[model samples]
Target chain A: MKAKPKQSRYLTLVLILGLIAACTPPAEKTAEPTSIVEADPLPSWNDGPRKEAIISFVEDVTDSASPNFIPVADRIATFDNDGTLWSEQPIYFQFFFALDRVKALAAEHPEWKNKQPYKAVLENDMPTLMQQGEHGLLEIVMSTHAGNTTDEFDSLVRSWIDTAQHPVKKRRYTELVFQPMLELLDFLRANDFKTFIVSGGGIEFMRPWVEGVYGIPKDQVVGSSIQTEYDYNNGKPIIKRLAKIDLIDDKEGKPIGINRYIGRKPVFAAGNSDGDLQMLRWTDANPLMSFQLYIHHTDSLREWAYDRDSHIGKFDIGLDEAIEKGWTVIDMQTDWKIIYPFEKNQ
Target chain B: MKAKPKQSRYLTLVLILGLIAACTPPAEKTAEPTSIVEADPLPSWNDGPRKEAIISFVEDVTDSASPNFIPVADRIATFDNDGTLWSEQPIYFQFFFALDRVKALAAEHPEWKNKQPYKAVLENDMPTLMQQGEHGLLEIVMSTHAGNTTDEFDSLVRSWIDTAQHPVKKRRYTELVFQPMLELLDFLRANDFKTFIVSGGGIEFMRPWVEGVYGIPKDQVVGSSIQTEYDYNNGKPIIKRLAKIDLIDDKEGKPIGINRYIGRKPVFAAGNSDGDLQMLRWTDANPLMSFQLYIHHTDSLREWAYDRDSHIGKFDIGLDEAIEKGWTVIDMQTDWKIIYPFEKNQ
Candidate 1:
């Protein structure tokens, strides 16, 4: 009772019923190739220079006869998740998740109502929360994200991802993912590229829903993780997620995370902020023909547009480097036909 | 120039030239799967109860209509490296690597000619080296394994693997990989299982050569690691491998490493020693159907056989658990037709 690939499943059914005529015609039907452009793979992307460059890079690496041909085994493409794949405007989506968690758990830990960061979160005071800064954010993240089995945390994230909506968008956080980026992921996979998410976000938080939303499987994700311990509770084993930080998986940590988890340099890497500069540099450093893409949020009317001046997902040095190096900078305003999938009809 | 999957390359060429005759037959020719066994995928495995069970497990998990059918993404299979996949006799093979490295490095560190561990390593003094114990081993391992950039370390391991031979076997260390295990890996992969090497060996040490020897990719390897630092050496970036221990990847740490790197519990896991107990337990704990395998070194004539009373690759607890749980146990002497690839002809 071996699991069959989709192609083989149909073939098995046809062959069992002695339907050779059924299989032959379908094979010939798919033979029409060069006469047509094989459907616009990146349909969400506008036919701009950035889109052209991205398609060209994929073609260069995949064409076996070309000088830039990369082996399929080495066709690793990494992406920064937050701003690169999904919206990180207002603040990182994970912060909202943490805030919501803090509110949910406030019932159990009533002291949160009086606590500085927790109190600020409860009152929905942004300035106060920002004043509390890194330590406060870590406190909220660790409190809600850890102190449970990985299974329990996965359940928590699944519940939140299923129910919670973006405060501004009035859509699920998963819905905030870029349609262009989703198309890009599909296009890369269609061409035999293994796409991975090397994110600064909590690995567990993304693992539960990434497969559904982005089509990136759990194991393919490389992200910031808390220290975990194997707790063999009388043979009912569980991996305990501790509050201690294990990996940051951002900036310099991105390359290190790639090395640790992937052990191969990505031929293509995409990012949005200065935090992604190191990863872009790392991908560009690959001996193979590599592509570095920077997504510039220039569409204020469609998606929030803030770059260098913004505190969250600040694009300063990486923007300068992308411009200087002539890397593909995705002008979200002009280059994207649509922002989120919800905007497709509009 | 996009990298072409072999299947598509031929199809594209035939369709472009309008050669319909060349393409039609290869499709239906492969349909006769039921009449014959698929080329005896595990050729090196003897036809015994262990082999039967292993094959049955694979068939059970892979059959699409079966209740036990695991989806391709969930079909993760992990193998312990040292004593399980290859031979780890007299001492762990990595120890041999470290000892040889110490001798090669002795001229640079002149004090090492008289040093306790280094002197012992240079003189081939096993009894004295054993006396220095874990602390001494760690010093040798760290000193030899770290301080270089990951690239440099990769080169060193590559060079060593290219030349190093097992003392007892007099064969290249890579050549000593179990023939049956290699076949098992291929069989699993052919069935769409993603195979990974989850070893206690150094991550860098395994990455450079495992792909060449075992057909397992570098990223798929989960192993013990030293802390790596991203050094942007005037824009010529390098990840410096430090002497600090980042992960142990043994015993309880095996499961922890699996969690960190894979982020999912494997449905299939194989091991030979007590150190792999936790990983096996964790895999068995998978909610989906799971298969745990223990490689019992019962072939004293062909390979060194020591299990319950052995110091290296001690198999007491794992053996008892395998027997008690009715899990698959590979008796090397009885179940394997050949030990290593070199022995295939013999």
Candidate 2:
């Protein structure tokens, strides 16, 4: 009796309700927005060395008469895309998305079960999964990312980001971006600074969402990328994506990429792990007045902390060196007022 | 008798009086006004086909709704330093500057006669000069450029440019710049384009006067350069120049330099020789709307007119190809209202 037309009608109603909710405006007001009234992400950042350092640097450098003053034209700032600007817990947000894509498309492609990386991803075996490391990750990306042009892949990523949720948090990864850092980016840009993202992530992967997430436009985002060839396919000129890595925009490669793309050394730099140490050092070595800040993940309950020896985002020697050089070190546990956006419920 | 100081002084005064009377403002405005009317350089350039083409392309790309519309942030335009925007005749301005430097400092450096390229330049021997070609040019640049830190070398170039005059035209090299191209540069920049000078000239030599001459700030000048090392000299860290050529920014090197430095294809390319051919081709290959224009030196009266076989600033194959491709070929004789600033004869 329940499996007849009544169930079909109920399904239709649910679909219409979901579409209506999607179209509805967010509850937050535009002028006096409720979102703006939320907890400050870095409330514990006292008006001491941490806060004063940034203000003094900005004021001094922006003052033309000051010996350390850098012209507004030369004020370039670079930020790491991963943990520095957004959350990278459990696994990097991209990895989680790739895993989900493999599962969702598995029914369409029955042979995925026999495939190596997709099979490993589908089974949800934790220890066995990561054993593939970068090689395994590259395989998953190539299998899913290829077979189409760059524009087609960008659409796929956009669709995934619109609906997919983080495994542990059950919230969109876009919501996991650090609100404090977003504010900082806006503040820097407001003061006539050109902010750029220099990341180890795939260039094509991050380019689609970077503008929306960080307010940094696509051209300003430099990252790892596979070699792409521009070709005419069926009278349409398309940039075809390849499976092999063309360049890795990480570590020493960071400085190379910065000099290659930016044509100027950044006066301000921020990062979260060892991968960013070279970029910080490069920024510090510039002739202009410079600032380098490293984010130290030290909170567990609030947002899960694992630094030092973490395989995914190691921050050991870099942390020690930052302290030695008197660089700004952001202690996540004590400095941040809030962690994830959902943590406000606590 | 003329060797006496008083006679030379009297002769100089007489010459000054004669020139002032001939070239100075009218009697009523001689001391009354004498205002330096900072000229627009190319005010008479009616919005013609070339101007319309450029404006339409930029407008379409910068407007978000248009299919070709790229963001203003992604609007990048690269211009060839010589011939495209300025005169490169009698000799490339940089080469002439190098020769003048060798001559002016010859009194102190008698040992230069014993050197290879210096000896070749001192004798004013054209055949031997052409024989050395690029290799000799590098030698001349290194001798004049190295042995000082970047700051000191920049000052040296600045001083030479400030006092020096072109041997043939008898005007300052900066005054020999094309008025029409200057307008084009400012026009592109006004529309939020990032314009760069991609040249074969020594980077250090171009940086000092480029800001004042072209209004292109130092950071935007990409050129051939010697290797530099960061060193602690006299308790201050500085980039010290060396004699070794790290990169040559010319011909095929031009495209490589653009790729290595800017990381994006130009939306608009303007050049004047075969050296710039590859750069224009590269820019023309952009999937987005693009424009390429070449300056053909066809006016013998207004400016030196020789192409196909001219030794300096040659325009053989590039001119033929530009005509074949139906690219806008700027006829300097007919298209321009003025050539060099001094060519006005005021």
Candidate 3:
């Protein structure tokens, strides 16, 4: 019964209203954001401020019409392996591997039974080993990590990762990976972000299992590395792992490692320690809409929750900075629905 | 009139013959290969043994039924950037960049006018610079390349590449990229191979424009790099390039660099000099079907031609090895339809 002109004008008004609603800020809208239309990409992340911030930021950067839109090629994300992605409670996983290696090789080197750090490692004397400090740790690392071809070292690392269990958790080290972080990685990758593992752990040690556990390929991993020399062994090319230190992907080294390996500023960076402060600072200071996420270990019952004063992953400085900068601070206990992937089944 | 059973049997026989024909090898077949269905991927590559071998190898490795089939993730192809992807005549493009930098900075440092390599560069005396050798070259490189933030260096390189002209050709340095090689890169990428530039040039220098010139991303470029330090300058994060030699991606260093950067052996490797011998050897020795291609600079009319005795990109050992191993030797004069992409419009 409506006139043709009246109907046309009504239709135009509806269309204009829809366009305005689409362009409205997410905070002003009642409807779910477009990013939330797909099945929850971060199912493990509980519906919280952290999750919402992450999703909104991703949507803003990926949406072409948005002023904050970042090109897919420039969507680089760097992640910290220990503490951030997985548990680093009893000590770094690589340190445990090195300690185990020292014990395994003790029979061959009878002299190690008498040496200071080696003897401490052989006897499982944590106090004595800790007393030796960085010097002792380096000694232990060099002795067990060097004198082998890269292939041999890789094989060794692979075998150890396959079998080694975390001391207190009694779980395979890879099993301790944070499910929420894993979901976060997948979410970022689905949005055309290239994810990299920027770790302080030995690069070779992580390369063997990172692809299998984290979906990050070997080349995408930037970590502390020992010097390797190319030599012909029995007329076959071999890269011998040397005792010398190359680059350490920690503290200020994180930015340097990102520059050296990725050759691009990361749009997103996640870490859980003071060592990650510079990396967070770098990522936050990116000349774009960058996201700096820090995972705070607040889940004491679900996972070991030591920070600020923890020896392994000290978080005091970074935590303060995160608050000051308004970066996403993931309170693990409240933010994550599940801690480890295994917890979902339980 | 034929009986019904006889007619059915005749139809089955025809279908069997068609299937057999489809499965026949290219050499034995009358029809075009499936890969050729889409357009000539390498139009600049003149139809020859070299081009045929490359196509055949790529098909074999990518074929699912073939025993030598490599999964897409493992299908890495590394190309030397300087002489393999681009022309390196008279001297390396990088050496030219370094010399120009020296001359530009000579005004600020009057002392450089008296220095060995700097003085040679200032005076444009190639003989004197050559006599000073690698030591003098390093001195010049360190003086000009270091002391700047990576961003500043990148900007400088970007500006220079955009404006600087090739001495003899008077073309932009990027215009000197080999057309055939560019086509080859695209062809390999289309066939699911991840292409990387494993060059001996400074990584920082090449990172600025390689993506635009060669379509190879910065992270995929493995090259010589200087040490860089992360520092807080004026309350901002900055990575300062240092004068120290980090990794030299040449000769034996090529294989080491590939392993360090790509973290996997390349299935296909291409180069034009002895410096790439180790890289080719590494690729050829992969535990899968591999292709080693050496570009022989036999084209004097279209591009400068030099081989065994040339100081820059010397092709002595690699050329001999290519012959011994039955590797694909690209006789640039005969095999390439065009030398540079710019020549196509002409």
State the lDDT of candidate 3 residue by residue for A208-290, as single tens digits. Answer: 88988899988899987777787755557788888777777788888988998889889999998887888888887789899
Candidate 1, TM-score vs. the true structure? Answer: 0.88
Each model's lDDT comes to 0.79, 0.67, 0.78
Chain A of candidate 2 compared with the true chain A, TM-score: 0.83
The local lDDT score (0 to 100) that residue A139 gets in candidate 2 is: 64
Query: Model 3 reaches what TM-score against the true structure?
Result: 0.88
TM agreement with the true structure for every prediction: 0.88, 0.69, 0.88
The residue-level lDDT of candidate 2 at A279 comes to 82
The fraction of reference interface contacts (C-alpha pairs within 8 A across chains A and B) present in each candidate is 0.72, 0.06, 0.58
Q: iRMS of candidate 2, one decimal?
A: 14.5
Q: i-RMS, every candidate?
A: 8.8, 14.5, 15.6
Ranking by DockQ: 1, 3, 2
Order the candidates by lDDT, highest first.
1, 3, 2
Q: Which numbered prediction scores highest in lDDT against the true structure?
A: 1
Candidate 1 whole-model C-alpha lDDT, 0 to 1: 0.79
User: Could you tell me the lDDT of residue A332 within candidate 3?
Assistant: 83
**Worst-scoring 10-residue span by lDDT in model 1 chain B:** B1-10
lDDT of 3 by residue, B273-322 (tens): 88798889888778888999999988666786678956443578889989
